[model samples]
Target: MSNLVEFNETSAPGFVLLGFTERAELRLLCFFVFFTIYAVTLAGNLGVVVLIRLDLGLHTPMYFFLSHLSLLDICYSSTIIPQALWSLVVAKPGISFPGCVTQLFSFATCATTECYILAAMAYDRFVAICNPLLYSVLMSQRLCVGLVAGAYLAGVISSTIHTVAIFHLPFCRSKKIDHFFCDGPPLLALSCSDTHLSELVVSALVGFNVLSTTAFIVTSYSRVLAAVFRMRSPPASRKTFSTCASHLVSITLYYGSSLFMYLRPSSRHSLEDDKVVSMLYSVAIPMLNPLIYSLRNADMKRAMRKARGRVLSLATRGSQAPERRGGPLHG
Candidate 1:
C-alpha cells in the first residue's frame, strides 16, 4: 500500500479540507447558514456562562457544571466553525500539518471533557433527588472543582494519545480531506499506512469514553427516576421531571450523533453522512444548549428576566444621563 510509504520529508505536508459543498452557489449558501449558526452559538453559550456567574441563585453545583459545558461548547465550536467558514469562501482551503494537529487536539479535548462533565452533572442530579439531605454536603465546592479538573485532565490525555497516534502515520495519499473539519476517521482513510492499529485505538478510546459516561448517566437517572416516582407531591414531581428533561434531550443529541460518527469502522464510513452528523453535535447542539436549559429551567428563566431588566434599566439611565449633562452644568 502506498500509505505504507512513511512521511520522511523534513518539511510537513499541507492538507485541503473539502468543505460541505463544491458548487459555487451552494458554497455561498452554506457559508451564510454556518456563519449564522456560529454567531448564535457564541452568543448563546457566552450568555449562559455569564448568567451563571452573575446570578447568585445559580451558584449551585448544577449551574457550575452547566457553565463549564457552555464554555466547552464555545471552545469546540470556535475551533471548527471559523476554519470551516473560511474553507467555504476560499478556492482552496488548506491547513498545514501542524494546524491540522492543533485543530484535532483542541476539538477532541473539548469533546472528551464535555462527556465527563455531563456525567458529573448526572451525579449532581442523583444526589439532589435521591439524597436531598446530603446534596449540599456531597456536592461540595471541593468535589465540584475536583470533578472539573479531572475532566480536563482526561481530555488532555485522550486527545494527546489520539493526536500523536494518527499524525505519526504516513500520509502518502491525497492530502484533501473529505469533510469540513479534521476528524479522525476521515484522516485515517487518507493515510497510506495500515490504519488497523489507529482505528482500534480510536474506537476503543471513544467507546470507553462514551459508554462509561453514558452508563454512569443512565444509572444516575435511573435512581433519580425511582425517587421521582416515589414523590407523593404532584408539584414536586412535575418540577423534577422538568429539570431532568432538558438534560435528557441534550444527552440524546450529543451522545447519539457522536456514537454514530465515531463507533463505526473506518471502511464503512460515508464522509457525506458523517459531515451532517458532525454538524448536529459540533454546531447545532452548542447553539441549542443555552436554549434547552434557559427555556426549560425556571431558575435560568428567572435569572434571564432579571438580567434583561438590569440591562434595560442601565440603558434608560445612560440615555437620561446624557440629556441631563447637555441641558445644564452640574454644580
Candidate 2:
C-alpha cells in the first residue's frame, strides 16, 4: 500500500534492490557460487566456535577472543549472505522498508562489534607478548567478559543511532537501492529528504570507529613487534610473530576493504565498486577466517584431529555395542 501510494505525505514502503544486472544468464551461476560461499562461511565459522568450546586446552584468552570473533563472523555473514543469495536466485529482489532497516541495523551491529572485538584481540596478543608477567592478571576472566560486553553494547548503540537516523528520513519518490545489501550510503541515496545530517552522523561514526580500532590494533602490534625483536632466540621470535600473522592478515584484509568502501568521499561513490569491496568483508573474509586460523595454528589442528578421532571412536563403539547385543551371546 505504501509503495503504491504516490509522493504525498507517506514514506516509501519498500525498496527495489538492483543487484548484479550485468548478465541475466549468469544469475543462476552467481546463485550457486554464492550459495557455496555462504555454506562454507557458516561451516567454517561454526567449526571454530565448536573447536573452541570442545577443546579445554583452548581456554586461554587468545582462543577465548577467537571464539568470540568466530561467533561474530557467523553473525556478520548471516546478516548479508542470505539476502544476497536470495537476490541472486529470485527474479524480483525487493526489500520492504522495515526489512531494509532491520538489515541495516543487523549489519551495522555486527560490523561495529567486529571492529571492537578485533581491537580486543589485538590487546590480548599485546599483553601475552609484551607483558607476559602481568598477562594473566591484566586480561583476567572478568576483564575479558567486560570487554566482550562492551563491544556488544557499543555495537548496539551505534547501530541504533544509524537506524533511527535512516528511518527518520522521508522517502517519497525513489525506492531503488543501487547495491546488493542495506548499507548506509545506498540507503541515504534513496531518501527524498536532505541527507546532510545522516551523512554527517555516518561520517563521524565511521571515522571514530575505524580510526580508534585501527589505532588500537596498530599500537598493540607495534608493541608486539618490539617485544618480539627483543627476544634472544631467533626461532622464538619467529614463532611469536607467527602466532599473530594470520590474525594480522585477516585484519588487514577486512579493514582495508571496509575503509576503502566507507571512508571515501561521496563524490567518488560507485555502486559497482562498493559491491565488490563489500564482498571482501561480508563474504570472503568469513570463509577465510577458519582456514587462516586453523591452517596456520598447530594447536587448532591438533585439537581438530583429536576431536575428529574421538567422534569416530565413539561412533564405532556405538555401532559395535548394538551389534554385540544383537549377536550370539558369549559362553
Candidate 3:
C-alpha cells in the first residue's frame, strides 16, 4: 500500500509530451487545423445541446440521449485540445504528473461514458423500430434517465479502475510521452516497472468494454434492418434508417479509430501511428458528430434558422433605435 501510494503521488516525475515538433513548417498548419476543429467541436456540441433544450419536439428519448452525447463530446475534446495548442507555443511542453493524471481521468471518464451511451442509443432505436408498440412503455422517461445515469456510472467506474491501475505502476524510464495526450497505451509504454500486469488489465478492460458495446450496436441494427425490410412502405424504411445513419457514421469513425489505437497489443504501439489515430478519435470525430447527427435533422435546422432570425432582428432593431433618437441618441 505504501509503495503504491508513493508511485501515484509526489514520486511521479514531470513528463514531457513530445508532440509534433520535428516538422516546424507543418506545425503551423497542424495548429490552424486543430484550432479550427476545436472551435467547431465546441460550437457543434453546444449548439445541439441548446437546440434540444429549446425545441419541444426534440424532447424525445433519442434526442435526450443525443444531448448527453453532445455534452460528453465537449468534455472529451476539452481534455486534450487546449493543452495541445499550448504545447505548440512553448519550447518545453511538459505536464506535471498530477496534471497528467487529471487529464487521463477526465478524458477516460467522458470516453467510456460515450461507449455505453452509444449502446443505450442503439437499444432505444431497437425498441422504437422493432417493437414500436411497447416503445413508450419500455423506454419511459424514468427509464431513459436511469439508463443515462447508468452510463455515467459505468464511465466513472471504468476510469477509476484504469487510473488506479496505470498510475500504480511507476513511470520511471524516460519522463517523456511521445504522444500529445496521456492515453493508456502510450502511458503504459513509459512504465519502468514490469508492465505485463498493467498491460493485461488495460487490454482486458478496454477490449471488453468496446467489444460488448459494439456487439450490442451490431445486433440491434441487424434486427432493425430485418424489421425495416419486412415493412411494405419504402418511405417508412428510409425514414427509419435515416434516424440511425448519423449514429452509424459516428460509431464507424470513433470505434474504428479507437480499436486501432487500443485493442492491439501494446508492443505494437507505434508512437507516430498512434498519435495520428489519436487525433482522429479525440479531435476530428467530436467536430464531425454534430454535423452528422443534426445537419439532416429538419427540426433542428428549423430551430437554428429561427434562432438566427431572432438574432438578426434584435440587431436590426437595436441599430435603428440609436439612429431614430435624433436629438442626443438616447444618451
Maximum-TM-score candidate: 1
Q: What C-alpha lDDT values do all the predictions have?
A: 0.92, 0.86, 0.85
Task: List model 2 lDDT by residue over 164-190, tens digit each.
Answer: 888899876677777888888887787
Residue 221, model 1: lDDT of 98
lDDT of 1 by residue, 1-331 (tens): 2222233233446888888876888988999999999999999999999999999999999999999999999998999999999888775578888999999999999999999999999999999999999988999999999999999999999999989889999987888889999989889989998899988898888899999999999999999999999999999999999999999999999999999999986767898999999999999999999999999999999999999999999999999998888776654
For residue 55, model 3's alpha carbon misses the true position, in angstroms, by 0.7
Best of the two (1, 3) by TM-score: 1
Instruction: Write down the TM-score for model 1.
Output: 0.93
* Candidate 3 segments exceeding 4 Å error: 1-12, 312-331
Clash counts for all predictions: 3, 0, 0
lDDT of 3 at 202: 73
State the TM-score for model 2. 0.92
The digit string of per-residue lDDT tens for model 3 on 1-331 reads: 1111122323446777777774656666767877999999999999999989987888989999999999999998899999887666554467898999999999889888999999999999999999999999999999999999999998999888888889998877777788888888788888888988877887777888899999999999999989999989999888888877888889999899989988887668898999899998988888999999877666667778888898899999998986888658556
